[model samples]
Target: MAGQRGTRVAGADLVDLLTRAQRALVRDLGTVLEEEGCTVDQWRVLRALAAEERSMGELAAALEIPHPTLTRVVDALVDSALLYRTQSEEDRRRVSVHVSPLGRTKLNRLESLAAAHERALATRIGPETVTRLTDLLRDLP
Candidate 1:
């Protein structure tokens, strides 16, 4: 019983550490993204759609965003002309979102900025450490 309690406490500590690290990383990256007039969530959506179009549900699942919040994000992007929605020809009710040319240009710029931010992080923490940490995180269930 005592051993199980210790393991639970250690698990909680790991969760807290991971959350804090994620928040710090996101906060720093958010500053870089802000220069391009983008938020982290918006950037995530754009990045996900960069390779191919996806239905709202697929995007929500891929990005771990709630459907309603994803809808608002898609609406804002559509209003900005960064993305467009098309109803499936065979399934009228099914709509998929695609990035516009302008959105691609913006995404390119954002990608550059993000790359630089990652490079800076690697430099600060040592590239080897960053690689190891990334691998370790990926190994987590």
Candidate 2:
């Protein structure tokens, strides 16, 4: 019983540490994206489209953003020529979005940038820390 209590306390502390670490990392990534003239939210959309085409609702849900907010992000990406919208054949009102060639190129660039950042993090935190942190985060609720 005592051992279990200690373990729970340690787990809670680890969660707090992970939360702060994630916030810092995301904030830095946001800065990097802003330098590239896009928000983290917008980059998320680009990343989503890079994988496959999806409707506005699907993209919104995948990104965990509201429909109205997602609409603005989609519009911005569309204006930047990174995404395009098309009507579904089965449902004319259902608009499917796909990443444009330019968007794909940008997505690849972002991936490269992320790799560079990951390497830097590896140097700072060691690969083992990253591996464990990743596993822990994946298991987090």
Candidate 3:
């Protein structure tokens, strides 16, 4: 049987729905990111580091990215001069990643583009519905 509009299917689960939504949203945002010479993962790393420097382990956990994959992403950003790594002052064995000034400039542009994309999405779907969905998603465990 076909699933009714705005209604869940009998076999559908929250994980499936969330995954599908995430993929679709990422694909849409990927286009904008591509124009800026960045990948979605790279964009995520930059965004996370914008607030403050973080250890690789901390970043991986906070971003929900695997350690190896996050390392590669960080490496690429470092090569681009968008990010830098430093030995931790508190722990000699630990290192922290930080966004560089160049990264901040790029992030500013990316943020504007992302905001425009979000606004477009809000216009397509009612803004109130988008706001409600965001609130609901944030409330989820």
Of the candidates shown, which would achieve the greatest lDDT relative to the real structure? 1
Cα-based lDDT at residue 2, candidate 1: 80
Q: Between 2 and 3, whose TM-score is larger?
A: 3
**How do these models rank on TM-score, best leading?**
1, 3, 2
RMSD of each: 2.9, 3.9, 2.9
Q: lDDT of all the models against the reference?
A: 0.93, 0.86, 0.92
Candidate 3 Cα lDDT to native: 0.92
Could you give candidate 3's per-residue lDDT for residues 77-134 as a string of tens digits? 9999999999977889899999999999999989988898899999999899899999
lDDT of 1 at 53: 99
Report the Cα lDDT for residue 26, model 2.
Answer: 82
Instruction: Indicate the residue-level lDDT of 82 in model 3.
Output: 100
| Model 2 stretches astray by more than 4 angstroms | 1-18
In TM-score terms, candidate 2 sits at 0.81
On lDDT, the stronger of 1 and 3 is 1
RMSD after Cα superposition, model 3: 2.9
